[model samples]
Target: MKKKTKKSFIEYGVIIAIFSGFYFTGLHTEVLGFLQRGILATGLMDPDFDKDSGHAVNTDYPEADFSMKLIDSKGENVAMEELKGKVIFINVWATWCPPCVAEMPGINKLFQDIDKDKTAFIMLSVDQDFQKAIDFNKRKGYDFEIYKSNGGIPSMFSSQSLPTTYVINSQGELVLTHMGMGDYNTNEFKEYLKELY
Candidate 1:
């Protein structure tokens, strides 16, 4: 009888161990799935502007003469020279970039609220598919002039990352280059724009 009781205890122990293993495995899988879904929902795989480590570009690079064709929301061809004599904010972005999408609405609002007669906001998409940019702008209902960088306009400006922006003075000189997006309507940006005029 003693031996039979010992065997029964061991058999129950094995069953409990197997059940615990399966339970833990299932819990781990659920946790992993939840994490994956959260990342996809937030679009966190795209590049982000690290505000803490970001450095401002000094107005020291030699003036570069570059021109490109821009397509408006209505699919009209516009020359870059049309923006001459105006303080221009040129943004280099891509549709797949999350930070670019987030900053775009703020830039649009800035354009609408500011004195458009003096300042012009230029959005140049570096996406390989020009149609993707057009579709994105259309879905977002954006009003800024969208352009394709066919002549390497982004590389000419020394942009190393997506969503880079350059502030040009009225004299057609690059004054400031921001590696990341900031508050476009803030006093800091307004003051910077005022310097061009």
Candidate 2:
């Protein structure tokens, strides 16, 4: 009985240590996000039918101007003001972020559905490796414009979290600001963009 108790304590200690490591290293959040995505994909969890679906983008901010200095994929400096007179969709995301990766397909679908001539899509990656951002875009076959912040990002758009997105109207006012992964391919989201134009 004493030997069995000792072995059980050791096993518990090992399990505790492993979980603590994962929690401290931020792997726990990633793991949970992965599981959530898997469950949603399996149809066991209804993503679209949820009455209080957290997957929808939250848009309740007052209209405000957006300005940013960014480097385009071609290494040319671009200003947000230059993108005025067009509906702008700005996404600050990183390739390593699981939520960012998961929402990318929806964003791409939105990009394809919109009129390119009247709207601009800027997907700025915050990856440490600039080349990795470029490579990821290429590998994913996303034709939407990719960029990196060249100057300080506005506080309104800044977040410690990855996958923040902003929608600005042609009149240079922010229409919506969203944080975290959301389904952007829905008609509701498309209607919001249409209203911006």
Worst 10 residues of 2 by lDDT: 46-55
Q: Specify the poorest-scoring 10-residue window by lDDT in model 1.
A: 46-55
The runs of at least 3 residues in candidate 2 whose Cα sits more than 4 Å from the true structure, single-residue gaps closed, are: 1-66
Model 1, residue pairs in steric clash: none
The deviation in Å at residue 37 for candidate 1 is: 20
lDDT of 2 at 71: 91
Q: What are the root-mean-square deviations of the candidates from the true structure over C-alphas?
A: 11.7, 6.7
Q: Residue by residue across 1-197, what tens digits does model 2's lDDT show? A: 99999999999999999989978885675565565565434533221222222223335434545568889878999887788778788889986787777777667888999988888998989988888789778887987879998878878778887778777776666656677666777776676677666
Candidate 1's displacement at residue 15, Å, is 30
Candidate 1: segments with Cα more than 4 A from true spot: 1-61
- Residue 8 lDDT in candidate 2: 100
